[model samples]
Target: MPTAPAAEPVPSVPSPLIRAFPTAPPPDGLPAERESTAPAATGPASPGGDAARTAAPAVEDDADAARRAARAPGRREQRYQETRARIVDAAADLFADRGFDAVSVVEIAKRAGVVEKTVFNHFPMKEGLVFDADPPMREALLDAVRKRPSGESVSAAAGSFVVAAVGLLGAPEAAEGVARMARVIRGSRTLQVREREILGELTDSLAGLIAEETRAWPGQVEPWLAAHAVLGLYASLLELARDRVLAGVTGPELSGELRRQGRRGLALLQFGLAGYAKRR
Candidate 1:
């Protein structure tokens, strides 16, 4: 009983909670420390944000201005072309109805519903209108001569083109139109001169093409002579069709006659002229 009453002093137990240490106080006059170190919040008025927002609008405005400037010239050129085409079409119809000399520039302008000045701006003169309308035919012939198949003789290429031209003349509508055009041309000395000049140009162009294809000198007599012969045959066929149409020929009658003439003419070219040209 005396031993139990003398129980040993109870030992003190340590607590499980960790002890907290106080951080050093901020410097004098400084604000209290924040829990998070993230950047401060900003409004639209902030310097860098304002600069980035302003830069985008300026760049977009500049790009839009450049695009408008680029399309302006193309729109202008398209309008000019449309106006020029109207003037040419009017001139062609007028010339067909009344010979080239018979129609005045003012008349053409009036028919086209445009000012005379506009016509002059495109053509410079009335003859240019007719020449422009008929350019495709001459261009086709020239291209055929220039781009003849490799290893094929120039005479063969020229002969083939001539046959094609004659076939075009045989078309009833073309035959009638050509008859009208021929009459107009014959009626005016000015147009006659222009026609001769155009034909001469065509001949010279063909001669040059032949020279290039054959590797001959441009001024050589042979190429020029061949060009003249080929063009002359084509001219004769054109004249034949025009004369028949003017003589009241039409339909199958005109077509059949033109076909016969074309066969005979082409046969002569194939046998006689082509052989002679090849030898040269």
Candidate 2:
């Protein structure tokens, strides 16, 4: 009789977090006021650098110019995009004033000067109104990847986008709109779900980009791992941003602190986690 040996189960790698879970959390921990402000770092991820740059930013379709710049858009396609823009804009204004749930698709159509069916045709659901930023956001990420520095890792380019995003949020013109929108989203569960769905889509899109960078196939392990890790970091960073706003942080204070922490996080990611547990 032959003796059989027991097989060992493989352990999965642990997911990383900005801070360990069940702890006090980042928002409660960030200093309410930064002592001083430093200039944003220049990198492939930043908006633009002073040095002679090599990467070309992604060229996205401008809402007003897309149809015209599309090299002779068909009448139907042109009109369709234009209508969708109107619906999105009208929905934004109305939703901002009355709140997400209080507004109806019919009212949105009325405000947009279109039929309800047109709204449905473009959006398929009311929650889409809250997600108009998805297209632009996705395009921004794509630009970061496409225009990343020649030697930088794809992950670093992504991290740079987060840094740039914080700076953009710090702008005086954007502060109120951002804070107001944050309040509105916090008030609506449906919009929260839509936002999560968008986040997932973005993760998938980024995964695709990572895979392409390495010439890997869909569902391949490398792209999938990198995508999840970076996107998960992005999720945490964003949640920290939201939490800070709720905690009464405002303006450049919020943006500066976030950008600082964001860059620090990216550095740790780039440097690799060695002896992290043994640290005091």
Candidate 3:
């Protein structure tokens, strides 16, 4: 009985009705208020969401501007090329049909369907339109000389190049084109001087290449002298062909004449100047 008297009283349990319910739904669409008021939540709103939303339009605008910038140069280049080609084609046709001196820039512009100012933009002077026809050919010739075989001498390389160039001149339609150019050049003193200067520059470039190939001295006069001699012979033959065309030569007549002159020139160089070339 004494041990049973020490028994403790049982604790009372709370009623379930007193437990809290979720706070009233935020007024209409105010979710932010409900979230901020709720007990410490597991996850909160992203900190960068507002900044990202605000920056989206700027990023899109920048991307559009960058895309336009990239396309602008290509569009300009295409327009420039189209305008230039139209001018050159018109010039070639006019020069062939009416000769150089008889045609005017206004007439060329009309033929090309462009303003005279546009023609000047592509070619500063009228002569540039005629002379720049085959610029790539000059580059190709230089590349060929630079890439000649190891055993080929400079004279041999030059001879081969001359043969190839003569053949180009002799190709169908090429002779006719040359005749037209000769007429144009002969009619204009400005064109003749420009052409001679261009030829001189080409000769100098070729001489430099020969000097490089032979490892000749920097100030050596022989390479330049040889280049000038060879180029002079070739130029003289070109003038001969031009004179023949002026005198009514055409087709096989012109081709045979040009070939004969070219062979004679090469032979003279080979036999007469055999010992003059830079020994490799």
lDDT, candidates in the order shown:
0.61, 0.60, 0.61
Ranking by TM-score: 1, 3, 2
Candidate 3 local lDDT, residue 186? 82
The TM-score of predicted model 2 comes to: 0.61
Query: Which candidate has the highest TM-score of all?
Result: 1
lDDT per residue as tens, model 1, 195-261: 6787787788888877765678646787787788777776776677768878887657765776566
RMSD of 3: 33.9
Judged by lDDT against the true structure, how good is candidate 3?
0.61
**Higher-scoring candidate on TM-score, 1 or 2:** 1
Clashing pairs in 3: none
Per-model TM-score on C-alpha atoms: 0.68, 0.61, 0.66
Candidate 1 global TM-score: 0.68
- Deviation in angstroms for 264 in model 3? 3.1
Off by over 4 Å in 2: 1-86, 217-219, 246-248, 273-280
Clashes of 1: 0
Ten consecutive residues with minimal summed lDDT in candidate 3?
A: 12-21
Writing each residue's lDDT as its tens digit, candidate 3 over 1-280 gives 1110111111111101000111122223212211122232233336886666666666666766777678778767866766667777788788777777788999999988999998988788787777653343355445655765665445545654554455344444555556677777788777788778777877887788778766789899878876776677657766776677667776677667666666666666656445554334
Instruction: Give RMSD to native, each candidate.
Output: 37.4, 20.8, 33.9
